[model samples]
Target: MFDKLTRTFSDVLRQVSGKSSISEKNIQDAVEEIKIALLEADVNLRVVRRFVNHTIEEARGEKVLRSVNPGQQFIKIVHDRMVNLLGSETEGLQLKGPDTLSPILFMGLQGSGKTTTCAKLALRLKKEGRKPLLVAADLVRPAAVKQLQLLGEQTGVPVFAVEGEKKPVKVVKQALSFAKKNSFNTMIVDTSGRMHLDDDLMKEIQEINSVLKPVEGLLVADAMTGQQAVEIAKEFNERVGITGVILSKFDSDTRGGAALSLKSVTKKPIKYVGVGEKIDELEQFHPDRMASRILGMGDVVSLVEKAQETIQEEEAEELQKKLQSSTFTLQDYLEQFTRIKKMGSLQSLVEMIPGMKGNIDEDALNSKEMKKEEAIILSMTLQERHNHRIIGPSRRKRIASGSGTSVFDVNRLLKKFDKMRLMMKKMTKNKKLQAQMLSQFNGNI
Candidate 1:
């Protein structure tokens, strides 16, 4: 996500890092580079101009040019402006919480993933111990109701849809009554949309809004749509009054113009972003964290939060023990891969590591190489997994045949495992290096 923009910023900052002192020409050159990067990312032209002007004015200030570390100071100025451009701070759903109606109305153009985003929001609320009801108010689109209901069942969230009621307002009324009777604290209404903005679609959404009186009117915009998304958001806010935005299909948006342009254009914060197709892949948008990620600083906080969700305490302790004892094996390696897969794509994880963004090819991570590695381990015997040393040439050939791979593949796996073991042993035995690593891990660096 935002890989191209991140790389551009990285290149400009890398140049600044080599500067002996900040000069007028230095700031001018850097700002020019930034302008080109933003324009290439498809950011709103007005927003990019304002950004360049603001950055240039600040970078030229005495406080920045005379700073002990001028490069770091200039970076801070740009980060602050980007944060402001992205929304000065994180904003959440304006729900009262408890026995209230708590209607969260979702609206967007057709094919914006609004239905799935509605289900994702319901799942999130359900996980937070709130009883959420999914209201399928998208009566215009054929099978939209059925789609929402299927997603609701899959996510273990209840759905309310009145059969044969073509009127979305009527369906929502029934859903509200259902929620009230069932004591549901949250209600998410999936509204109808058209291929493009139209009077009929806007009127239907406005009527739905009037009936639901939602606590949050969220527009589900596709980040891939670029500036058109910003325009959609503005029109929605003007016509139906959206409270926030949910950037759907954001994980696939490499340029990231919509995410950076939406807030500035609509004056609405992006409350959530759809990171993947899964129901659990929705993430709350954080301005500071996104700013850090955009600047190649990585989002360690989000990485740790993701790990907390996927890794258990005892499992981590057991992995630590294995590392310390130098007892890691093929089984452990396979298990590690499975865990990382659960968290997200390997490329996304790599992007979250500081200085490694845009350096990994996502296709490479998803290629036959990963599958072959897993297959080779699965073909190995239990004893072979515990002690790979017993696997000779004949055993390697058998394992390769069993795994539908070549003998060379087996050899490659063994060599990689040997390198990993050596690295673990080297790190565990070096006390000073271990201390330095601990300090860095603890953010002392």
Candidate 2:
């Protein structure tokens, strides 16, 4: 996600990395490259101009001129400005009260992933101890209600849909009654979307807003739409007063223009982002972390949160013990991969590791490789997994044939596993190394 923008920033920074001092000419050249990069990524022209101008003005300061490391100073200025452009702070949904119902109406265009995001939010809320009722108010699109209903079933949330109900307002009205009777604390209304932002769509959303008085009228914009997402957000905010944005397809947006420009254009923070298609992939947006990632700095906090959410404490403890003893088996190694898979895609997980953010090769961490590793491990016998030392060439050939791979592939995997065990042993004993690893996200190389 945002791979292009990150590469652009990293490239621009590299040109100035070893400079003794940042001259005006150096600043100009770097800013010009950044401007082109932003424009190429389809960032809003105004946002690009403001960001470049702010960065130039700040870089000319005496603090940077007299700094020991001018390159780090330049990085700080750009990181801060990017954070401001992306919304300086994180903002969550504005719910009415703890005891009252807060209806969140999702609005966007067709194919914007609004309905799926609605279910993601409902599932997140349910996990947080909120009884959420999914209201299928999107009556315009064919099977929109059924889509939301299926997602609700997958997420273990109740869906409020009236069969043959074509009126969105009426559906929401009955959903409200049902929610209140059943003691649901929140109602997520998957409102209708259009092929384009038409007057009828606006008016219908307005009616839903007026009737339900939704606590949050969120526009679910597709980040892959580039600058058009900014325009859509502006129109939505103008016509229907959307409180925030939920950027869908964020994980697939390589350019990152919409996520950067939407907050500035709409004057509304992005409350959440759809990181993947899974119901558990919607994440609360954090501006600082996002800024960090865009500048080739990793987001360790988000990474840690993802780990804690996916890995059980006891499981983590047992894994740590195994690693410390240098007794981690192939079974433990495969389990580690499984746990990491639960966190997210390998590409995304690599981006969270501090120094590894801009440095990971997509082909190297490809999901196909992950699947192959799993297959090889699964093909091994219990004895082979327990003690890899017992697997000689014949055992390796057997495992390779069983896993549909060659003998060389099995050898490569065993080599990697051996290196990993050594690294784990070192990490367990080396406090300074562990601290250095943990501090990788401080934004100073």
Candidate 3:
């Protein structure tokens, strides 16, 4: 998601990549470049100053000048500073009620996706085997209640709401009582959001806090807002108190300034990031992996975790077997697309990969193109899906017509799939070929 920042760091690293020694002049030049990059990405001036200063001090103190790979060493120093800015480490949610029901208060501004994030968090907790009840206390917005209800329904969690309790505190208190009666071990209170920070809003939230006594108070913010997101987090923390920050719309941010600045400005750990609109799109925020990503290195660990969470164990196992055996086919292709669709948008998936972040058309992946592709595949019969060779010109026309597409569209997918399968098959047969493929995949020269 941090395409601009990632590109900036990669370019800076490139300037030092092949150097055998670093001079003071060169280091100063690089630091100046970093300052501009950070500023361009909307990083706070104070943060940028500290970052460049720390990087220079560390670069000199570590004797990067004498190192054989001075450029790499310099980049490492910058990477470390970025990690510090983005929170030194990940933080876990608090569940401290005798291993029973624990209350968590969700707070944010309107249009911050607070309600969606609440359901995503509950789904995350449920994945960890924690039974969480979604309490829809945003009674101010009519659609808010319905949105939470749909999320709960999709995630198979219970949504607790009263018919006429207008006050958020009253709704939460009653929701908690209902949860306790139903044996729910965890209650997530989704509170209402306001257009701007106000005294009345703070009072209502404080009153809700007094009644529910939430162990965790999370502020959901849109990552696209950049430094404004961080400012919002600070204001919320100062007024209502927040335990952590949840960065939503992460899939849309290219500058990534918000993620880098929020934790440092607010002095709160980022617990999770919302990658997509799906309930399962929430990813636990990890500093080290995020650092790697900012350095233009792929996050393989997070990628695997995402796959495991989204794909069924048996299905993934089968895919692995097929990969090893060179049995990849159109059927396997369709299965992979389905799995990826469940995970999130294809553009977000591309961004998570090592070097394809800025190159992928995010809108295309998340748009009707993806749906069109799926429809084209689904229009094929079982035999056609398994064996692409059987789809003759007449059948191609029929399938295209059935799927509301042109023959060219179907041909494009098949051509790409064939090339990919052939390349994978060749790589499967030779370890060195596979390594070379991986190297090329990572954008190495």
The reply for model 1, stretches above 4 Å from the true place, is 359-367, 428-431, 434-445
Per-model TM-score, in order, reads 0.95, 0.95, 0.90
Better of 1 and 2 by lDDT: 1
User: How much is 445 displaced in model 1, in angstroms?
Assistant: 9.8
TM-score of 1: 0.95
* Model 2 stretches astray by more than 4 angstroms: 438-445
Each model's lDDT: 0.88, 0.87, 0.83
Pairs in steric clash, model 3 = 101-185
lDDT of 3 by residue, 97-179 (tens): 54578999999988889999999999988878888999988887778998999999999999998877777887888888888
Candidate 2 lDDT, 89-115, residue by residue in tens:
999888766688988888999999999
The candidate with the higher TM-score, 2 or 3, is: 2
lDDT, residue 340, model 1: 81
- Alpha-carbon runs more than 4 Å astray in model 3: 312-317, 320-326, 359-375, 406-413, 436-445
